[model samples]
Each structure stands twice: as C-alpha cells, then as structure tokens.
Target: MHFTAEQRLDGGVLERTFTLGEIPGILWTPASTSAPVPLILLGHPPLGLRTMYPRLVDRARRAAADGFAAATIELPGSGDRPRWAAAEQARADLRRAVAAGGPVDDHVVDALVLPLVEKSVPEWQAALDALLSLPEIGGPVGYSGGVISIGIRLAVVEPRISAAVLFAGSLVPAVLFEEARRVTVPLHVLLQWDDEGNDRRAALDLFDAFGSEEKTLHATMGGHTGVPQFAGESAARFLARHLK
Candidate 1:
C-alpha cells in the first residue's frame, strides 16, 4: 500500500488517500496519541469515491471525534478502477425493471448483486490487512454503513470485525439471507422506512435472519439519505460499546 496524499482536517483528524494494488482508498485518524485507536471500516455503495466523498468524510470525522480511526476502499468496478461489462449490463436491466414499476426480477437482483459481493468482499479483507498494519490504526474493528449485503458477507467471513452498523438502503439478493444467518457479531442495522430503492419487508427479514445473539434494528421514518444526525450518534455509541 502506498499513500499518495495527506491533509489535516478540523478537530485534529488526519486524512490520507492511498492505493492498495489497483484499489483507491482513504483513511482518517484522530489526533496523535500514544496508543493506536480502534478502526472503523466505513462501507459505502459502489457509487465511486468521488461521488461519495462528502458523506464518507463526514462519517469518518464523526468516528474520529468518537475516538476511533476510519477507512474506506473503492469497490471493484467502481471509482477510478476498471469497469465490468457484465455488471454494467446487470445495472441497465435493474434500471429498466425499476422504471417499469413492477417487481424486480430475481435474476436481475442476483446478476447485479451476487457478482459484486463475490468480488468486493475479498478486496475489503485485503484493505483491512493494510489498514491494520498502520501504526495509528488498530483492532478490534467495527464496520459501518453499506452496501448492506457486503457488510453481511464481511461480518460472516472477516472475524476481525467485532461489530457492524449496516444500512438497509439497497435490495439484498436472496442468497445473502443465508449468509446473514452466519453473522455472529453484534450488529446495529439502520433502515429508512420510506426508502424508494429498497424493499422494506426484505430488509426486515434480513435483519431477522442475523444469527448474532445481539442485534438491533433501528428504523426511522425517512427516505434514503435522510438519516437524522442523532441516528448516527446512536450508532457510534453502539460501536463504542463493543469496539472500545
């Protein structure tokens, strides 16, 4: 891993941009301290880092203020990375189905999300390896935000993540429901009750499927991107309860 840039943000947070192999990523650390801080992996949609920067930085800063280090890596076929033709086609199909105002076909959801889960989970694991090697970042780790499916996969496969805050803002393919049953870490799931892009019933079912002995589903009344500030504070408290 190689860092390409570094800057200081308000509140004594240090922000650095880096690349691991071909994947671009960003890391934010709180003010210098003698002890290494617990890390939060800030998960986001495949919406390219440039498009998602404002929100990602905001979340990172919050984590910093809460005495944690945060980091995020671009997903496969997203940001400045090379694109996949099959995924592109799957996206087009999904759009067409949504525009038609009919139920999205099972095949379309599988095509679009399954491959993404298959490719991106390993990349996130690799990023965790590099981030943990840094002097300023340490474990036990927490993962916050989504694609919710990716978070589910990570929770099941990446044992280093002690807790997770998953946003139910995207459609989860059926296969991941089984994986959800394998997630044994504590989870805080956020759901936007009026999300236009997600299936509310499926989101609830997914939450019910989690095998974790401790899991909370925090649902709020809003559309996607309308999560209240207090909701984030609640999530931070949940992470602190476990990661700290």
Candidate 2:
C-alpha cells in the first residue's frame, strides 16, 4: 500500500507510477484503498511528451476516490521514450488538423498513421488484459481516449471486457464500424461540439453503428479533454450498470 508522486505543472497534478507485475504505468489513484474497485483505463492522444496532463490526473484520482481505480497509460514510443520521425509526422498532422488547419501534406505522415494505429491497439489490449487480471480490480473496465478512442473500441469488443466509455475518437478504415455493431456490452460515447479530428457527426455515426441495445451518447462543451472531466461520475454509472 505504498506509492510515489511526481509533481508537475506547479503541483496542479502529479504523475503516479504503479507496479503491475513487471510492467509499470504512470497513473493516478486514490491514496487509500478501502475496497476492491472498478478501473478506468485512459488511452492518451499521440503526444510526443510523456508528461501526464493535470486535468486527466485529477479526473483519474477523483474516480479512484469514488470507488473506482483510474489509470492513464503512455503508449510505446511516447513520453520518455525515443521518438521516431514517422511517429512525429503522424502527430504533427493531428496537431495541424486540431488547429483548424488543412491536412498535412507530408507523405511520411500518411504512411505512418495507420501502422501506428494498428501497433498501439495490441499494446493497449495487452495492458487492459493485464490490469483486469490483477486481484485489486474487481469491477468492470472502462476507457477514454482522444486520438486513441478507436483503439478502445477495438479492445472493448473482445469478450473479456464488460463495458467501455469513448471520447473524441472513432473506428477507422470505416469497416470497423460494422464490427462495432456486433458488440453486446453497453457503450457510452462522449462527443465534443467542435472536435477537429473526429467531430460530433462521426461520433453519432459510430453510435448508430454500435447497434447495442444499451448504448448511450452525451455531449459536452469542451473539445476532446472535456470528456474526461466527467470520467469519474459518468464512468461510475456505466460500470455500475454493466459490471454487475
């Protein structure tokens, strides 16, 4: 029951690393553990920096206090890891689009985008599987991501997952939406009003494609980041309803 905290952004948030078997992840959790709890796995945007966002850490910490364990994961090649030019190109394209700019003209960006997407999915799936296997996590699983939202969708469709929460991301290659239609678990999607990459319409289309009997969609004012502000309460409700 011991932990360490790395203060960041003038103490607004702290990056907490937790040991999961041999694999360690930077996460935010409650200081005290009174019960076995559900978990929220945060899938981050494809940022080159490893610094954990203060708002995300705050949201995760709050979720843990509310009887859920929340953790944000740093994808491979992101944050404290060596960067690849290909990855950087892909990230730049996303940043440009977010600024209301046109698509990146770099061919390298286009070439690396889908490969990175595919690579990250399996890594996240393995991370979730390992987390669920832990004895301390007794409740269902949920996820939220900006650029990585589609990865969460791919992970949740697996039989092991009970429920999922997605933010500002979508299934890609267009065909995955068809696969999403077959998922039986309850899914809640949070959409942003002016999401540059995956806008509201895209979220609506995915929701319609889900075809889940228990799916729900909600909207918020802030763009991608706004969705996680509700991570504590909104996810709690979904996990309670579905995890049981």
Full-model lDDT for every candidate: 0.91, 0.59
What lDDT tens digits, residue by residue, belong to model 1 across residues 1-244?
9999999998778999999998999999987757999999999988999999999999998888888999999998898999999999999999999999888998898899999999999999999999999887778999999788899999999999999999984477878888899999999999999988888998888888999999999998899989998988899899999988
lDDT of 1 at 58: 93
Output the TM-score of candidate 2: 0.73
Model 2 regions more than 4 Å off: 1-24, 27-31, 93-113, 226-232
Candidate 1 has a TM-score of 0.97
Residue 50's lDDT in candidate 2? 45
Model 2: lDDT of residue 170: 42
Model 1 residue runs over 4 Å out of place are none
Candidate 2 per-residue lDDT, tens place, 1-244, comes to 2234554433233345654433346654445555666777776565532455665666565565566666655565676655677767666665665576564343534444466666666666776676666566765666654453354445445555667766635424454555567766677766776665554665677777775678777766666545544644775567656654
